[model samples]
Target: MRLIIAGLFALAVMLSPAAYAVQPDEIMADPVKEARARDLSRELRCMVCQNQSIDDSEAPLARDLRLLVRERIAAGDSDSQVIDFLVARYGEFVLLKPRFERQTWLLWLLTPLALAGGGLALWMHGRRRPKSAPGEDGSEAILSAAEEARLQRLMAAEPPPESPS
Candidate 1:
């Protein structure tokens, strides 16, 4: 149906990953510089929109960051230089991907450390609990001497079970 086709088209548009928040006035005149600026925008996190990059955020802070990146690029700063400037202005938290320096080594190493800890815990748990033997019931009837004597007396008091052959 036409309605079904329209709905599918709308859903497809929504599901696509091509969303960008860059405005027309923000684009640089030079193509190469614009490309570099765009790439830098992708690398920088928008402070106002915590999880989104400046290139994909509509926040006023994101717009200012985009302009700032373009200005730095125009001023003949290299990608690394621009990034360093941003880092110096705002702490290392501004970068979407953090450098693996001494200060950030713990952040990089934590996942593997946690995984190893989990694996060790699983191994220790496995060692502590032995597997039950196949075809063997673990439960056993444990009776004390008094209990055994009482059981014997009760058995003697009961009539023999009639067997049907």
Candidate 2:
């Protein structure tokens, strides 16, 4: 009885993920239609699950997305048309692969531009720095001999160091 119960528990755990909403029977029988549906599902958002793909999401919204995709495929809508319809209805946020033109051009280019800008800024800043030296003398190389003599006199006039004893 204990072993049977344990086996049943394991089986339920294994099958639980399949129960998340979409059933295999919902997919079209034609292989070409099925492939298109799969591709669209991967691109469409699970409106309920938000971050999950329609194909993998168990949300009611994901199921609706799946059904909508199949219906569009059946209605002779081409892939781009169906995607356009969804984008029109749901905004570009629904697309897993956002288009690169116009408003979204920044999304594709901003990071590299920022990195290159930052690299150039860093390179310029580094170029302005004097090469590493043993002491602070290198930083003060512009000072005249008179300035150094005055600074040395100031240092020499300081009180004697106190003993720690």
Candidate 3:
């Protein structure tokens, strides 16, 4: 009976809606404003949980940010205006997806630049490698004629191994 109750409890927990950091009091009365606030919250980064958005973080800073967004919406601030305010107050680090601007140009451009540089390096490496010579049997020869001759001479000079008793 205990095992069955435990199994049912586990199943109930699994079926429950995903928990969010937003508390009931933080939600705005107006549906449209609430939606806008939620959207903005998802875009804003949690200062305490650097990788998580304020909407998904339970930290005190995240809660404060969530309330600030709702407060801005209630005061009739446009979405862009709220974002600009946050950016001004906390800098670009407050945004989960940073704006493409002069200061962040290198952050946005580095990946493509690195990929292009790597491709150029690979192409140059391939060009510098010697082309293989085709053998009489239509197979590529891995060793030069001088190296092959030296290998043959070395093999001839080595004694034959005795058969196992």
Question: Which candidate gets the maximum TM-score versus the true structure?
Answer: 3
Candidate 3: how many backbone clashes?
Answer: 0
What are the lDDT scores of the predictions, listed in order?
Answer: 0.90, 0.85, 0.90
- Model 1 lDDT vs. the true structure? 0.90
Pairs in clash, predicted candidate 1: none
Runs of candidate 2 with Cα error greater than 4 angstroms are 1-21, 134-165
Of the pair 1 and 2, which is ahead by TM-score?
Answer: 1
The local distance difference test score of model 3 is 0.90
Write one digit per residue (lDDT tens) for candidate 1, span 60-95. 888899999999999999999999999999889999
Listing every candidate in turn, what is its Cα RMSD in Å to the true structure after a full C-alpha superposition?
6.2, 5.3, 5.5
The reply for model 1, stretches above 4 Å from the true place, is: 1-20, 134-165
lDDT by residue for model 3 over 40-152, one digit each (tens)? 99999999999999998889999999999988888989999999999999999999999999999999999999999999999999999887556756886689799999999
